[model samples]
Target chain A: MTEADHETVRSGLETHLPRLWRYGLSLSRNPSVAEELVQATCLRALERQSQFRTGTNLRAWLFTILSSIWKNQLRAEKVRTGGGFADPETELVFDGAASMETNNLLRRVLSEVSELPEAQRQAVILVYVEEFTYREAAHILEVPIGTIMSRLSAARGKLAGLDSSATNARKTRADEVGKN
Target chain B: MVSAGMADHPRDEDLVAYLDGELALADRQALDQALSDSADLRARLEVLRGGDRPFRESFDLLLDAAPLERMRAALPDPTISASVISTTQTPPIPANDWRSLGIAAMLLLAIGIGFAVGFGTRSDMGDTALLAELDALEAELEEAEAAADAAPVATVKGWRQAVADYQVLFTTDSLTPDQGGDGALALASSQVGLNLDPATRAAAGLEFRRAQVLAFNSKPLVQLAYLGDDGVPVAFCIIASNKPEAGTQYEQRNGLGIVHWIIGGYGLMVIGDLPEERLNSIARDLRKSIQL
Candidate 1:
C-alpha cells in the first residue's frame, strides 16, 4: 500500500474499532476474543486495502472480514478438536422463584441473549444490537437470508420464554412475601 | 417449522420479519391485518420484541469498554512513512555540512544527558534517594511475601512481558508463518510437558488456533493461541522454569489479564483480555485437564 493508503486505513480502523469490538463480543462471547478479532480485522483490512472498494460501506466490509476470520478459525478448531456440548437451554433456564427485578433489565436481557446458542446469539446481536438489516447480517454471516430469519425467530422465541419465566418468578416471590 | 399450537397462526419467522419490517409491502399489510384481528398474534409479537430492548442495552457495555489502544499503537506510523516517502522523492542530501553536524551532535548530547538524568533520579535529586529505593524495594518484597502466602512460587515477570510482546507481534506480518514459522503441536510437545490438544483446551471453553515458539527475555516459550467459544483469544504459554514448583499468580498488564502458574518444571501462563476471575477459571480448568 502507498503511504497515503496506510494513513487512510489507519484512520478507518480507528473509527471502526469500537463497533468491530462490539460485534466481536457479540459473536464470540469473550472480551479477549473480541479484541483479537478486532485486531485481526484491522490487520486484514490494512493488508488487503486494495481489495476494499472505495465507494462501498467500510463498516460492513470490516464486519464481513471479522466474521470470515472468526468462522475460518472456528472451522479450523472444529477440525483439530471437537468440544463437549453444553446444553444452553438447561444452563440458561431461570428458576421459578428467582428475582427478575434487576435494576438493569437491559443488561440482564443481553446477558441472557449472550447465553444463547452461538448462531442464534449472533443473529440476535446483529439484528437487534447492531441494527443490521437482515440482508447485511446475512451477507456478513455468509448465511442465507432464510437462515438468518430462522435464527432470529428461534432467538426471539427463546427470549420470550426466558422473560415469562422471569416474570413468573417475580410474581411467585411477591405472592410469598404477601402471604408472610 | 410452525409449532403445533401455532398451526393456524403465522410462522414465528413471519412474525419476526413483520416486527423487523423486513416484509414486503403486501406481506406487511397482511401481517398488520392479522395483528389487528388476532390478540394472540400481537401478544406474541410483543414478547418477541421484548428481547430487542435488553439485547440492545447489553451492547452499550461494549461501546463503553476500553478502546483498543494497543492495537492502534501497532499500526504503521504515517508520519514515519511520510518522511520515508519524502526522502525517496527528494534529491540526496549534500555532503553533511559542519554547521548542521555540530547542531545535531549537540542535540544528541543534550537528549542523552536528559535520558540519563531521568533514569537515574526520575527528576528527583534529593538526599531521599535511599528512602525512595528502600520504599520501592519494601513494596516489592511485600508483594512477593503475599504471593508466597497464597502459593509458594517464584515470580516470572518474563511471562507477562512475553504476553505484552506477543500482543504486538500478533498484529504484524511478522506473526505469519513466513516470519515466526508456525510451530505445530509436535514442536510444542517437545518444548514442554503439555500438549496443545483440543480436548484439553475445550475443557476451558477454548479452541486451539496455532502454536509458535516465541522468545521473551532471552527465553523460548511455547505459545499456543486458542479461541474461546465467543471468539476471545486465549494464549496458553509454557516456558522452562528454573524452579520446578507449582503455584498460581494473577496479574493485569496493558489491559490484558494474565494467570500464570507453575506445574512440574514448566511455567504455564493463560493470558487474554479477560477478567481476573475468568482467567482463574480457565487456569483452574487447564490445571485439571493438563495433568501437570
Candidate 2:
C-alpha cells in the first residue's frame, strides 16, 4: 500500500480493533471465538479497503461491519448451539463470599447484567461499558435512538432487580451472622 | 394540576440523555427536579452507570494484553520509497563548469607570471612590488577564511563567528530600523544571497518553519529553506560571526530580508519583508533603540 493508504489502514485498525474484539466477546462470550471474530473483521476490512472513506470515523464503520458479521454469520450457529450459556447457580456462586462480601455483591450484579437479553446486553455494553453515546451505539447497531433507549431501559430495570435481590441476600447473611 | 405534578417517573431514555448531557435544557431541568423527588429513579440510574466499571476495566486489560508487535504485524508495509522518488529529483550539475573556471584562472595566472619573468629579463622594473601585492591579497583571503573557521562546531560560538564574517561585508554601525539608507544594510542584504548557516538564520530572528539545513560552508556559512508560518516560501543564506562581538547576516529568496550584527559582547539584526527603505527604517531603529 501507499504510505497514505498504510497510515489510513493502521490508524483505522488501532482505533477500532479493541471495540471490535469487545463486541465479539459479547456476542460469542468465549475468548477464542472473540479472537477469531476480530481477526475475520480485520481481514474483511483489508479486503474491502476501497469501501472505507478517508477522514470518516473508522470506529463506527468497523463496529457496523462486526455487528453485521455477528448477526448474519454467527447468530444462527450461536443460537443453535447455545454452547457458551452461563449456568446461573454456578456462575453466581462465589468462593470468597463470606470473607469478601462486598466483592461478592459486585460480582453477582455483573453476572446478572451478563444474563440480560442479547439486545439489552449489547445496548448496555455499548453505552455503559464501551462509553459510546446513545446515538453512536444506535448507528453502530443499525437501530434508532429510541430502540437503544428502550434496550438500555430494560437492561437497567433488570440490573436494579438483581441489585435489590443481592442486597436482600446480603442483609439476610448479615442477620444470620449477628444471630450467631 | 395535582395529576400533572404527580406525572410518572421520567423514562430510562431521559435518564440516559441526562447522563450524556444531551437532554434539552428544559428536559434536563425537569429530570433534575424529578431526580430530587424520586430516590428509586436516582438509584436505578446510578447502578446502570456504575455497573459497567468492571467490564471496562477487564476490556482494557484484554486490549493491553495484545502485544504491540502483533498490532504492527497486522499493518501493511508503507511504500515510502515510491512516494519519495516521485516527489523530487536533484538536477544534474554541468560537469565541466567549475573545472573550466579553474583551468582558465590558472592559465591566466601562468601567463601573468611568464610575462613578469620575461619583462624582468629585458628591463629592471618593480616586478617584485607587483608579486608582493598579489601574495598579500592571497594571505588576507586566507586569514579571513581561517578567522571564520576558528569557531567551534554546532556551538553558539560558531554561530557568533558566522555572524561576524557576514557583518564585515557591511559598514560598522549597529543596524536598526531608523537607518533606512545605510550602506551596511544594503551590503548585509546583498550578502544574504550567499549560502550560509541555517541555524544562525533561525537564531538571528528569521522565522523558518519546518526548515532543514541543506549545506554548511566551512564553519560559519549555511543554506536553508522552509515554508514560513505565513505559508510563504522562505530561503535563508546565513553567516555566523564568532568575534568577541557576534552577529548574523540573512537574505531571503521569496519572503523576508534579515541582517544581524553582534559587536562588543552584544548581538543584533534587521528582519522583515518590506522594501529596502522600510527595512532600513527597521534596521536603524534596531541599531539605535535595541541593546543587542
Candidate 3:
C-alpha cells in the first residue's frame, strides 16, 4: 500500500504539470524557466515523496516545493543569468486561433497581474486565480493570512483600475451597438 | 437602511475575500446587508469584482499553451530519482546549547577557511587581491551565520518562531475578552520583570484580550494578546535578555508578520495576522508609547 501510494504521487505529478508550469511561469515570467522550475519541483517531489502526508493536499504541497525552490536558490541563480528580471508576457499570453484583438481585455488584465510586485502577484495568483482560500495561500506562501489579505487588498486597488476601464470599454461597445 | 453592524465600510481586503466567497460567515451577514443598502458600497464591490472569470480563463489559456508533452517527457526517471537531490540539503541541527552553538560557529569558520583556500589556489599569483576579497566575504558570512545561531535572545529554542507557531492557533474565541488591566497582566509583569502594560498602548482597532505568562528556558515570557477589530489575533511577546539594545528588525514566521527589537534589557516582538507594513506601523507605535 505504501508503494502504491508513492506510485499514486508520481502519476499524480502528471495531472498537475500544466498548472505547475503555469505557476512556474507566473513566478519566473519565462516559459522555459517555468518549465525548468516544474522539472526541478517534480524531481524534488519524487525524491522526498516519503515525507508527503498521504491523503492531504498534494497540489498545495507541490506548490510549496516549487515556491521554496524559487525563493531559496533558483531565484539567485536566475538573477546571475539575467533571467530573473525578464518580463515575457508576450510569450506567456495565449496565442491560439483566437485573434489577439478579441483577447484585449483578458490580455490587459493578465499583463496588469503579471506586472504586480512579486509578493502581490503570488498572492493574486494563488488566492484569486488558483482559488486557494486565504488560509491555504497563507500556508503555501509561508505568510499569515493577514499578509495574504493585505496583498489581495493592494492587488485589488491596482486591478480595480483595469476593471473599471474594461467595464467602460464594454459600455462604449454596447452604446455603439445600440444596446440599452 | 444601514444596520449598526455597518459601523464602517468593510475594507477592500474584506470585500475581496467576500467576492471570493471566503469571508467568514461571522462577517458575511453584515457585509451582505451593507451591500444591499449602500449603492456606493455596491459600486466599490463592482470595481473589485469580475477578475475571477477572466483570471481563470486567461490562466486556462496559458495552461493550454503549456508544453505538456515536453514537460512529461522531461520528468526524471522514477526508478533512480531519489539520488538526484542536491547534497547541500542539511538537516537542521538544533542550536539549543551554547556549547553546540560554539561548535557550529567553529565548523562554519573552518568551512569558510577551506572554501577560501580551495578558491585561492585556483586564482593566479597576480590575483592575490581577489583571493583576499573572497576570504573576507566568506568570513563575514560565517560570522553572521554563527551570530544568528548563537544569539542569546533566543538561546535554547527559536523562541520567536515558537511564539508565532503557537499564535496561529489563536481565534477570537481562543482569547476570552478582558480589558487586560487585571491580575493577569500584574502576574505576567511580575514574572517577566517588565511592565505588561496595555494602559500605555493606544488602542487602534486592536482590543486587548488577555495577558498570560509563558516560559522558555525557565525565563518568563509575557504574551499580551489582542484581537484586531476585524477579528485577527495579534500578540506582543517579551522576555528578559542581556543583549545590547537593537533597532526594530522585521521577520516573518508561521505566516505572520513580526517586528522585534531589544530595549531596556528585554527582547520585544509584535506579531500578528497582519501585513508587514501594518505590523511595522504598530511596532513603531509601541516603541514610542510603551515606555520601558
Q: How does each model score on TM-score?
A: 0.47, 0.42, 0.49
Where model 2 places Cα greater than 4 Å from the true spot, the runs are: A1-6, A81-110, A162-180, B1-9, B35-55, B64-292
Name the candidate that leads on DockQ.
3
Q: Where is the poorest 10-residue window by lDDT in model 1 chain B?
A: B111-120
| Minimal lDDT window, size 10, model 1 chain A | A90-99
How well is each residue in A76-156 modelled by candidate 3, as lDDT tens digits?
666654534453433344343134444776776677777777899899889767878888898888988878976876677
Between candidates 1 and 3, the lDDT winner:
3
Question: Which lDDT tens digits does candidate 2 get at residues B53-131?
Answer: 3555434433543334433433322221111111111123222122212222222222222212221122124435444
Residue-wise C-alpha lDDT for candidate 3, range B189-213, written one tens digit per residue: 6766665575335557777776755
TM-score of chain A of 1: 0.71
Candidate 3 differs from the real structure by a C-alpha RMSD in angstroms, to one decimal, of 19.4
Query: Candidates sorted by DockQ, descending order?
Result: 3, 1, 2
lDDT of 1 by residue, B1-292 (tens): 2222222356667788888889877677777887888897798678878645555655665465534674454343443222111211212322211122222222212211111111112233432443344335345544644665686444544555646534422321112212112345655565455665642355457666566544344344566666664666677777777776757899777667888877688788888877788888888877776656
Q: Of the pair 1 and 3, which is ahead by TM-score?
A: 3
User: Candidate 1, residues A1-180: lDDT per residue as tens digits?
Assistant: 454655566688788888887777566444444555676676457546656765567788888999997787533442232211122332221221123443465556656776777899888878887888999999999999889987887777777774545544543554565456
